[model samples]
Target chain A: MFEIKDLKASIEEKDILNGLSLTIKPGEIHAIMGPNGSGKSTLAKVISGHPDFEDPEGDIKLDGKDILDLEPDERANEGVFLAFQYPVDIPGVNNSEFLRMAYNAKQKYQNQPEIDPFDFESLIKEKLTVLNMKEAFLSRPVNHGFSGGEKKRNEILQMLMLDPRVVILDETDSGLDIDSLKQVSDAINHFKSENKMILIITHYQRLLNHIVPDTVHIMADGKITKSGDKSLALTLEDQGYDAFKDNQS
Target chain B: MLSKTTNPKTMELETLQKQARDAFNTLGFPTKRHENWLYWTPDNEQKALERKFYEPSDSIKENDVILIKNGSLRSKPNNNNLTVSNDTHDYQNENLSFNLDSSSLSYLNTSECSEVITIRCRGIINEPLQIRLESDHTKDNSTVNTKVNLIVEEHSSITATFYHQQLGGAFNLTNTSFELVCKDNANVNISHVFKDNKSKAFFHSIIHMHEKSNCNHISYVTNSLLTRHDTNVTFYKEEASLNLKGINLLTGEEQFYNHLTINHKSKNCFCKQHFKTILDDKSISEFSGLVYVAKGSHEVDSQQMNQILLFSDSARALSRPQLKIDADDVQCAHGSTIGQLNPEEIHYIKSRGLTESEAKALLTYGFAEEIIEEIQDSHLKEALAQDIKETVRKIKS
Candidate 1:
């Protein structure tokens, strides 16, 4: 299970996530719909251990263990993965090499035998084929000159390779075209498992339409104001976030 | 310089040496007040200037390899097609001369140089001539003076590599002067690799390009200590092109300064200067290049740029990419960029489970790939790639 208990966070003394709480049991997909500044992305950053935010004040427990004290890499090694909203561009690092290094890092953390480049090659190629990325993509620098859709697909590729227990998708559908959105959603669906917990944070209900979340949460002023079945996303889509502005306590 | 007798050549050299000695006496050592000598923090490097001139062995065996150790000839194979001589008369093409007064070290080289090696190439040579410069570390706090002349005759094509070995003894000083002459329609490719000098080192090189000649040069610097380079390339005739680039990967208090001046004396020439620096720890580096196109040199094209990547907050990068154009109808552009490792980029890599140091090492290596891929020699490129991987691993360890 992945759980955030009253997650209170801030940036530069400005409160962003004020007492926000959510929980997703194993085999569940939770979609978070909110307005622009409603702390959805902040939730992702806090979970991924971004240094920009202030030291969070609540517990972020992964499988009953609080990970507030862990470094970003340690949290990642401990099965926390956040696919960024705006993926960074690493100008000179080869995509294949970066993926291999990330895989080996996980392997080393788990005290398992690390995979060499030659052995890891076929495994990554399989993921690349599944994502429909060309072979030339491996030779390019990681997201350096990639288009918007390519960057999103690269994030999905990373999630597939890392195989984390807790997956946080932060606005992975914004810059993607309709075709890319469907393809990336199909990839996420293919990656779903009964042992994993997925958190989908988005502004619209379009992504939820494809992924069909188990639950929908309406967030406002840094906290969740309402929670219900997947049909709640349809309601928010039809009525807009104005319906929840006055409902938060 | 058309004297057929050997005595006139000797006398000409002797008189030139006398003039150089007088010049050095009048100029002495440069101070911080001089514009060109600004970044020089003198740590008692006057010993090199005060050392007595040493005698050089003249037994010339023409080997493909010319080895010089502390201003003494170690090996020269006679089997190669190159003509190695002590004479400097025909070594120069029409009205060409080494700019000895450009730097104080050039004056020091002319005054104290005991031996001079001149290699003349007349045709296309596939094999690269190797000039290995090593330091004799048996003695403590020593000084060395060495010089070389390379002349490529008309319609000739040649390649050469000047390899500077790692100096590993008591701190000392060295002054070296190198000159190259390219005649009409000549093509020359040269590489200078300087590594781990234990003390102060000053090196100067002047290249004179004649009509329709093209020269490609690259300098690879790593692990240097208080080193300075003065490189000058002058276009003596029209339709010549000079491509010069340098990569300096420095760490741990190493200071490197490179001053490059490209002078276009004739019309219809192209010149380029691209330099990159990857600095770590508290190392310091500066790239000051000046491109001056004379009034009559119309239709000249030149480009200059410097990119610096610093790893530590204490590391400093100084860039001075200046241009002086007295002529109209020319194309020139110069700019510089100094940036640190992006934290967001670091977080993205860290989110993938790699440690911070590993992310840093990978990104830093990628930063230098732009220049590393520019190397035309495959073996050298592979070796350098491996070398940089090791160097990056040692950072913050």
Candidate 2:
């Protein structure tokens, strides 16, 4: 459902992703593991249309349609979701109000009926039950005073609400505790179906234990160094990216 | 005679114009030499637009109460509690009278307006009165002056919205003065919205808050063309509190100057002033606030914060906060910030599903929402929000 060919991305004239390529089919889960500055998060941001992640040469497609020219919101409308590493803290904007606007924007783009306030409230409540988020969180400003775990969970909650066909999780497990990590994994597992594709981007294998990926790709120096089955993630957990760094030279 | 020859309409306005012109000629325009005008005075560079006079509109539609045309006063719709009992307020108390003797605005409004609308409320009104003053007619230079005095009885609470809506292509000068006599333990919310046209417009507003009364004034002035507004609010009496917030978001050659003074006469009084201005192109925004703590006025708390966001290199802002404390044991502090959008906030919002323009709009909206949300009336809040959004859209578009 997702494909990238020779993706090259940069920031402020500094190249981060050079000739990166990956593909994940429906019903499959993939994990991209790399060390610091290895372009793991850059890959995710590039796919999500981050303005800072400029693509000089590449083609990224979802379901056979080029998405390089689409805006971030337009990509989300096309069932592409990116779970940011750190959610923004927007004061004076109610969390529910932001969600409603985003939800309606996507719905309108997809030609679906917009949800009213009442129905939207109930819908958020139902999703909150799945993510174990408190009702008070809905009324507070977006991520204004949220803890690390809460921000991560809020990201997952958005993924669930939008129900994107191709989900890209960027460092989604970095700040989560064991319990919160399991909850987030459970939420992802609940949405796991035959028609959805998930890409988990992380440096550790802890998240892999909960939501096992069908394939593991080791990224180093802005390009994929190796790809294998789930055993590669386990081997990297025991060994680390040191093995891949040596192979690069 | 000069003003009349330039724009001849009615004998009433011509007579009033002659009277105002004679007053101005005798006592030239108030300058820095005058104590009251020391802190505020237009430079010689600002050419004076000719002031013309027109008939007042007293039509009483609920929506039209706030919508005055020409120089006439319109009653707030369904303001039964505000019985228009015609009685002039004795402006003199001790040696100080709010009524300025040689002021052209005071002379024109007091002499010409034989019938003054006395707006009073004993209980909370279901709908806050909306006063929309519209100026769409222009034969030559036009002038619209109004004096509205609001009195809230003891233990009464009400919210009133005063709107100055000007749309035309003539030089216009409008003056509005309000006296809010809030009896003990009364609360009043006053919101002023100024929507001026492409014509050269000048507006001056003065409000007085009385003893033990709580008053909140939210002023929003957006100049689509060339315009200037001067506002002053004074809080008198012990334990009386006031909040003064003003926002000027403008483009083109619009210029706005706002000066607020809080006179803490009695003990234990507090006041807060927060003003934000968004300027683009060659527009200018000026803010001046002074907190005066009189002798024996102990424990007076006051704070003033002015934040200006300049989106263009040519846009300018000047903010000055002055504090005078006669009492020793008082807390008074002031601060001003003038800068562009925070790069961190912009990046944060952009990381989400928003583009650069979309993220800037959201961040700027959040900054302005601080003052807009403090409005007590829901309808006014919505209207102000929509207006602000429209401004943002214009800036972005």
lDDT score, residue B276, model 1? 84
Regions of candidate 2 where Cα sits further than 4 Å from its true position: A111-122, A226-244, B1-27, B30-80, B89-96, B99-118, B121-126, B132-137, B196-201, B223-227, B265-267, B280-282, B292-299, B309-314, B321-333, B337-364
Between which residue pairs do clashes occur in model 1?
B61-B76, B61-B78, B62-B77, B62-B78, B63-B76, B63-B77, B63-B78
- Give the TM-scores of the predictions, in the order they appear: 0.90, 0.81
- Best-fitting candidate, measured by lDDT? 1
Q: After aligning candidate 1 to the native by TM-score, how far in Å is the CA of B15 from where it should be?
A: 2.9
Model 1 Cα lDDT, one tens digit per residue, B136-175: 5444555677777888888998878888763644356777
lDDT of 2 by residue, B77-97 (tens): 555555433334322221222
Candidate 2's TM-score: 0.81
Query: Each candidate's chain B TM-score?
Result: 0.90, 0.82
Give lDDT for model 2. 0.73
Local accuracy of candidate 2 as per-residue lDDT tens digits, A139-234:
888788899998899888888877889999999998999999999999999989999999999988889999999999999989998999989998
What is the lDDT, from 0 to 100, of the residue B86 in candidate 1?
A: 56
**lDDT at B255, model 2:** 74
Q: Which of the numbered candidates is closest to the native, going by highest DockQ?
A: 1
